[model samples]
Target: MEIFPAVARVTFDGQVRSFDPSVERTEMERGLPKQRLLNSQVLVKQSMTLYFASIGDATTFESWYFDVIKRIGWFEMVHPYSGQTIKARFENGALGDLVPDEKLTGDFKMDTVVEYMR
Candidate 1:
């Protein structure tokens, strides 16, 4: 039985990103890991902090950040610049994961996914 993981495609600021990877599970567990998958899609609204490591003074760029989905359904990001924090609500658009998974061994594969509100 070959079961494939679900794929999530998200768009923001007129850009579309796709995430295709398997959900993580422990050796003793039979279900997916509780953590959000890397490359998973999410939504972000205005007033949300888009964090990035600037090249000198430039602030924003096309990049990816690992964000956490809050219970209130907002996305929180730690500004890589100021070290301050910011958040995006479900009202704006969507966010997604763009990080790739690391292959530990030949048969062992572990990855993460993101959650979003639509």
Candidate 2:
């Protein structure tokens, strides 16, 4: 199996951007390099101090984040589009290679932090 190191940044406004240093076209074409590698896509959602929103409610915002990560091209699966059924392995980390820092302010702040590792 090959390991792809990635960095992602998420802002308070629900803007997310990602970068992967070891990602390449060949690696992406071959997917996650496991015969039984799970097929999944990464979906990111954020909740501010007073509001909650789902991916369906902000498709364009989610797409922007997805696009940044897709540039890394580290998976061997088809790209997922809105309303499309696709599978992809999920992974998460922060940009700058640091562990994510989270704080609680509201009733559901703890639930706001999400991470997926493949």
Candidate 3:
């Protein structure tokens, strides 16, 4: 399994978590609705913001993102919300952009969304 690049001295923001349950529902004409789980495992999605303290750190991550992930489309990393290692992929095939520091400093920030593939 390929691990995400561990850029040093980066600040990690709290993850915004969401999930989609694998369920099917049916409504009876004269009774309560019935639901059944199609799959045991749900799909987990998380959005995370990373603040790179330096350009070097940002470049390292960018390289890995484009070279490794963009090609393979998925990788293993520690889940920001669950605190456990999981297989993940870029959400909706969207590759996030690296925004530079507003003050012209050699810093960068990136907001990314990842889906947990159980």
Evaluated with TM-score, which candidate comes out highest? 3
* Candidate 2 CA-lDDT value: 0.29
Candidate 1 structure quality by residue, lDDT tens digits, 2-105: 11111221213232223335356445466654654554544432222222222211111222222223222444543323444545333322433333323222
User: How high is each candidate's TM-score?
Assistant: 0.20, 0.18, 0.81
Q: Output the better candidate (2/3) by lDDT.
A: 3
Between prediction 1 and prediction 3, the one with superior lDDT is 3
Clashes of 2: 6
Ranking by lDDT: 3, 1, 2
Please report the candidate that would top lDDT against the real structure. Answer: 3
Q: Report, for all candidates in order, the number of backbone clashes.
A: 11, 6, 0
Q: Identify the runs in model 1 with alpha carbons over 4 angstroms from their true place.
A: 1-72, 90-93, 97-118
Model 3: per-residue lDDT, tens digit, 26-117?
A: 99998899999999888888888777778889888778877777744778877665578888877886746778866458877777777885
- Global CA lDDT computed for model 3: 0.74
Runs with alpha carbons beyond 4 Å of true place in candidate 3: 8-14, 101-104
List, residue by residue over 11-107, the lDDT tens digit for candidate 2: 3453243332233233346557423323343343222111213323234323433564442223322222232322332344222222223442321
Which lDDT values do the candidates have, in the order given? 0.30, 0.29, 0.74
